[model samples]
Each structure stands twice: as structure tokens, then as C-alpha cells.
Target: MQINREQLFRASCLSLLVTSLSFGIRAGILNKLGVDFQLDKAQLGSITATAFWGFPLAVVFGGFIVDVIGMKRLLVLAFLFHLAGILLTIFAQGFWTLYISTLLVGLANGTVEAACNPLVTSLYTDNKTTKLNHFHLWFPGGIVIGTLIVLLFNKIGLGWQVQVGVMLIPTLIYGYLFSRLDFPVTERVASGVSTGDMYKAILNPLFIFMFICMFGTAITELFTGQWIDVLLKNVTDNALLILTLDTGVMVIGRGFAKPVLKKISPQALLLISAILGAIGIYLLGTLTGNAVFFAAIIFGMGVCFFWPTMLGFVNTNMPETGALGLNLMGGAGMFAVSIYTMFMGSYYDRVVAEAHGNGAFAGQQILHTTLIIPCVLVVAFIGLNIYMKGRAKKSAAAVQV
Candidate 1:
């Protein structure tokens, strides 16, 4: 089939936007839900992290389904899950219901990502990394969109439940577009690759490095994206207003990554991203006044490309692995977040408990705790950068021979 690159790209972006919707809801709307349910930090994290929990399962299974059933079917299922979860969440009375709803939401998200990541690569096989970054720009972009929605609703005195339910509009529209569109063939399909070859490729040192990078990248990016609202609310004077500001800065950073990835190698870009993220997260935890805002912009810049860039790398080097590789990386990343979220969730409650409403300092400590994730990200990038550089040299040398 002839591939219309533009149409496929648009579809990929929309898929990413929809998949990221659950994260937006968790990040921007979850805390308010915490108040609604009278829940604690632990429950908040559990319900919020439920969507990501599907990652491990989805990563292993989502790719197989994508390979067997196709992207179109997987995407349709994802949209259904997203729509159902959002509607269920609207009327959820207590912690258990919300938890189950979020888990369903997570399943939809996992399926969407499983379907779309390989679709983007198949669309622009010539420029896998660049296209992948362009594809993933929507995730942060969705956060910006979702943040604006939340801010607009708050300004108008709308209920959080209505704001949550309003996501149904885009959910339906994107699903419709996905239904009409014919998805491109997978890299594995196009190459006519065998499963044994793909699985063996997964064991390659470079492949393993990319896999681990996904885990660290997920932890770094999701940790901030998921918790920043609460982190900002705790430290800043105008809590709700800061979400817009932070997400806005994050959007700008993500949008710029397309150009930035072109100018610098992904490895270099990642290292720079790590340094910026580390500084930004650390400052967010420790600093005050206008400084915190500046730090947030820096941190957003740090993480802006971590996920997309890493995916780009995997797709470039291991195109034959197809949706399985993408999902494996994505699932690994989310699994890292699930682990970190649980820790941070418990840790956040502990810090809040210690302070007992005393003020900004308590918030500062929680914000500081977030630094651990970014710090780990910095190290993760350093390791991945070294491996990528070595691999690049090996590829170039092989070509020379």
C-alpha cells in the first residue's frame, strides 16, 4: 500500500495525544480527586499509577497483538478503554472505583502507544529518530492542552468531574480518525523478519542499553509530568496557576526538540537534557520565588526529548523488532515509573505527615525528593550516551569496510 506520510503522521500524533490524555488527567486532575475521595498520598499514587501498571503487561502483549491483529484494531480498542475509563471516573464515589477506572485507562494508554510508536517509525523509516520525536511531541503537547482545559474550567468555577468527562470529545474524534485511516505496515512486516531474529536482536548489547535507557527515561519524564502539579502546588503561592506555567514551558521545550534533535546527535541532546533536568528538579526542590519558575523551564527542557529520543534510537537500530520493541521500551519505562511512583507516593505522605501543614518547607522537601529520579536520569543518560556513541562508531566503521 502507498503510504501518505502526512496522513500517517497526523494519525500518529493524534494517537499520542489520546494516549497521553490519561497522564494529563492523572497529573492535573488526580490531586483534586484525592480531595474528593479523602484519600492519602499512597492511594493517590496507586490510582494514578494504575494506568502505567498496564505498561509491563501491555509491553509484552501489546506488541504481539499489534503484530498479529494490526495497529487499527489496537487503536480502536485503546480509544474504547480511554472513553470508558473517563466516563467511569466521572461518577466514581470512592478509592476502589477510581482505582479500577484508572487501571482501565492505563490499559487504553498502553494499547494506544503499542499501536502508534511502530506506526510512526514505519511511516518515516528514513528518519526514524526525527519522526519519532515529532510523533511524541504530542504527549507533552497534550499535557499543555489538558492543563489549559483544567485552568479554564477552574477559572469558570466548573467541577473537576465535568472537566474530566469533557475529554470524551477528543477521545471520540481521534478514535473516529483512527477507524477511517489505514495504518502502515510494521518494520518487521515490511522487512519480512522472523520472530527468532527479532528476539535475538533484543539480546544485543546495544538493544539492552536502549531498553534500560527507556526505563530510566520513563522514570525521569513521568515522575515530573505526573507529580509536578502537586509539587508546584506545595511550594508555590499560586498552586493551580503554576500548572499552566509549568506545562506551557514543557510544551515549548518538547516542540523545540524536533529542531534540537536535528542539530545535535540524540546522544548529545540526551546528556544536555539530563544536566538541564537535574538542575531544574534540584532547584525546584530547594529554591524559591521567581527562581522556581526558571528552574521548572530548565527541567522541562531537560526531559523534553528523553522519551521520544530514546524511542527514536531503538527504532533506528532495531527496526525489525517493530511494535514489540517499542512496547518493550515503553512498558519498561512505565514500570520504572510505577516503582518510583509508589516510592514517591509513600515518601510524599511521609514528608507531608512530618510537616503537618506548617508551610512551604514541607513542600520543599517533597519537591526535593523528586530530585532523586532526575538525578538517576542524568546517570542513565550518561550510560546510554556512551553506548550510543560506541554503536555509532561501530556502524560507521562497518560501512567503511
Candidate 2:
């Protein structure tokens, strides 16, 4: 069977677009769900948590079995889950329905990533990092599209249900595109890497170390994004624009990632990103009104290299771990985001109670505390940068000997 790599890649991007659009749709609809369903803050958070938590369940499971099940079957699952999730959410009557719908969307999202990440690595073996960056730009790209959809809907007096229903368009498009193409064997499989070797590679002390780092990196990016609409609403009328502008910056930065990699090592990029992240978060918390846009740009740039570069570094550095390792990294990140989603919700409610229901104060207070995560990451990345460089030198020296 002949594979049209470009068509497959486009399908993969649209699949991811559906995943990110879910994020945008949920962000835009949180308040609507809260009011229409008569749910409390914690319940809404729990519902949101379902989406986050559902991702890891699919990603970890899908990652483990993707090779055996075949990428095409996994994508078929994504399309079906996506279709069901969108339709169910459109008809959701209460908390349970909304919760289940979000979970389905999340599962679909994870399945898409599970299938596509390995697929891209397989398709572009020579330049995995640069291409991964290209592939991941769709994440922000999709969010931008989703956000616009939300805003456009908001302007026309359409409600959240219709906002969600719009996701079906791209979902169907990708489904059709994928149905027509032939999937290549995963890069790990094609390279003749044994399953045993792939399993062994994940337990490598370095893989474990990076796995821990994945928690910090993923939380820094995903948690902020998940909560952005809530966190900034009180501070800026342009609250949505903060997310829009930041993601727009991310789109531009990721589009040009190839040149960026030529100048900086991934480790160095991670360290720099951590520093920018800390500054960006703090600035967003402290500043108000239009000044928030500046913080948004800095935050966007900070996170630009985070998702792709982390996956690229591990995949390139730890080739033996194969698709399983990539999925684990992705799963770990999503898992962390899920945990924080719950935590942030509880924390917000507590702060509001303590402050006598001051959401603005609660918002700023949480941002202050969240700033610590990225601050700690700054130090962690410095050490990581040093270690990776030294390790590279040792590998070169060993080859010479």
C-alpha cells in the first residue's frame, strides 16, 4: 500500500486541532455550564478535571498498545470518540452529561496524540525535533481557531452548545482524510527495535529523571492554559485576548522552530523557557488591564519550546524507548495537568471562602503561588542543561576511543 505522507500528516494535524479546540470550547463555556447546570465551583472543576485526567488514561493505555493495535485503529477510535463527545456535549442537560462529554473529548484527544506523535517520528526520522515542533504548532494553531470560533459565536448570540457543535467540522474532515491513507509502521518498529528494548529504555535512570521533569514542564504550560480564562477575567476585559495573543505568539514561534533549534540546544532552550515562564506568570499576576498583553507574549514565548522540545529531546536521546517513551512523556504531562486542575479548583474555592468571596484577590493569590513551580524549574533546567552537555561530550569521547 502506498502512503501519502503529506495527507497523513495533515490528518494528524486536524486530529490535534480537534483536541485543542476542545480546550478552547471548554474554556469559553465554563461559566455557561456553571450557571445553566447550577453547579458549584468545585463541581465545575471536577468536571474540568475529567477532561484532563481522561487524557492520561487514553494516552498511557494507547501509547502502550499503539504499536500492537496499529495507528489506524487508534485514529478510528479518536474519530468516533470525538464525534460522540461533541454530540453529547451539545445535548448535555446537567453536570453528569457535561462531565461525560468532556471525558470523551479528552479520551479522543489523547488517542489522537497517541497515534500521531509516533506517526510523525516515523515519517520524519532525520529531523525529529524540528518536525515535532512543526507538528505541535497545530496545538496552538487549533486553539487559535477554536478561540475565534468561541468569540464569533459569542458575538452572534449563540450559546455554548453550538460552540461545541462546531468542532464536528474538523473532526469529520480528519476522519475522512485518515480513512483514505495508509499508515506507516512506527519508527521504533521500522528501526527493528525490540519490544523488550523499548520497555528497558523507559526505566533508564535518565528517562525517569526526565519523566519527573515532565511534571514541572507540563503543569507550567497546561495548568495556566486550563485556568487562563478564569484567572484573568477579573483583571482584564481583554481576558480572552490574553489567551488569544499568547497562543498567537506560540503559533508564530513554533512555526519558526527550525531556525530556533539551529542556534540553541534543547536543554538550553528548556532552561531559558523556564526563566521566561517565571517572569511571564509573575507579570500576569501582578499587572492589570492592557499591560497583561505584554505578559501574554512573554508567557507564550516561554511555553513555545516546552511541549515539542521535551518530546523531541527524549525521543532523540532515548531512541530505544520508542513510541512507548514518547507516549509516557505525553501521558505524564497530561496526568500532571489533570492533578493540578483539581487542585487549582479546590484552592480557588478555599481562597474565595477565606477572602469572603473575592475572586479577583483569589485569582492574583493563586498566580503568586503558581509562580513557585516555574521558579523551581529554572534551577532544575540549569542542572539539566549542564548534565546533557556533559553527557554529549562523554558520548563523543567514547566514540573517539
TM-score of each: 0.93, 0.98
CA lDDT, every model vs. true structure: 0.76, 0.89
Best by TM-score: 2
Tens digit per residue, CA lDDT, model 1, 1-401: 56677876786687678666657756777778888889987999888778778656665688877878888888888888888888888889899889888888888878878888888877777878877777787887777777777778878999888878877887888888877776777878888888888877777777787787676667767777677777667567655445446556666766666677668887788788778877877777777777777776776777777888888877776776677888888888998888888877887777777888543665577666666766776777788778777877999999999
- Candidate 1, residue 61: how far the Cα is off, in Å: 1.5
Query: Which parts of model 1 have CA positions greater than 4 angstroms off?
Result: 357-359, 394-401
Candidate 2 lDDT by residue in tens digits, 86-183: 99999998989989998999899899989999999999988999989998998888777778888899999999888888899999999998888999
Stretches off by above 4 angstroms in model 2 are none
Error of 1 at 192 (Å): 1.7
